[model samples]
Target: MSDWRASREAVELARLGVSELLANVAKHTASRRCGLRLVRVGADVVVQVFDESKQLPVVRTPDWCSEDGRGLWLLREMADGFGYMPIPLVTDTSYRLGKVVWFSCWGALPEAGAA
Candidate 1:
């Protein structure tokens, strides 16, 4: 198995991003169940959250007075890139339409490729 891991900052950001996404799931969707994946590509780490809800996330302008709606906007500013896309979810019975929200950040160790 690969021992690769993201940098501390990257991991921290990923944690925050995941928390916000899961919170959205709990507040906006009927089901809170979802899938999470972390993948490393070169010097970057990608975090993906898959949910059965077909509704995509929107980046809203920050309203300091508001309690919500700042998660995506803040994430976009902190992450190298962030976006969402429709995806096919596999199940025992049939395919379901869902979405994968993802963000990428630079995190690999400088000696990642070194012996």
Candidate 2:
């Protein structure tokens, strides 16, 4: 495992992102259950949350009086890059989506996607 002490901020951001992602899952997914998959690519980490919602996540501008709708907003601020992909599963009542969130710090100097 890599030492996250040097990049605690990124880890913390990932934590926050994951929290909001999961919360969104609970609130939006057509199904009651959701699954999360995390993978490490070089010095970066990618987090993907799969749910039954046929709709994709939207990064919306939060209303001033709203207490929610700021999850992906915070995630974009914390991630190096974010991606959304539709899963190719054959189903009628359920669908799967792939959300990719990457951390800027997590690997060694030469492995962190630096030039």
Candidate 3:
């Protein structure tokens, strides 16, 4: 992720976004096993976090007086777009912890550059 800052040009913003994402996963889901997925798709850098939780994320006002909850909000503002993808909703009665908190940022590539 060295180029994270270089690529985003808004290094601090990108760093804050990534840091908050990790922290949220630890605090909200509290899952033991988790991982990050970074993908370079066209002109966007897609950041994905996978965890073992059934809770779906929503955009809500995190108490400003508190020390947290501004992560997703900030990320949303900084990113081109972001959202969660639930595991394949199958007909079976089996439930699974296969959801991801994902976001995309305009990379340093020309395609994403200001027109």
Best by lDDT: 1
| Better candidate by lDDT, 1 or 3 | 1
Instruction: List the candidates' TM-scores in order.
Output: 0.88, 0.70, 0.72
Alpha-carbon lDDT, every model: 0.82, 0.62, 0.68
* CA RMSD per model (angstroms): 2.3, 4.7, 4.7
Tens-digit lDDT track of model 3 for 26-64: 788856466788776665677787777768777777788
Sorted on lDDT, highest at the top, how do the candidates line up? 1, 3, 2
The clash tally of candidate 2 reads 0
Query: On residues 16-100, what C-alpha lDDT tens digit does candidate 1 reach at each position?
Result: 9999888888887777789989887767788899888888888878889997789989999999989999999898999988999
Number of backbone collisions per candidate: 0, 0, 0
- Which candidate has the top score in TM-score? 1
lDDT comparing candidate 1 with the true structure? 0.82
* Model 3: residues with Cα > 4 Å off, grouped in runs: 1-11, 88-95, 110-115
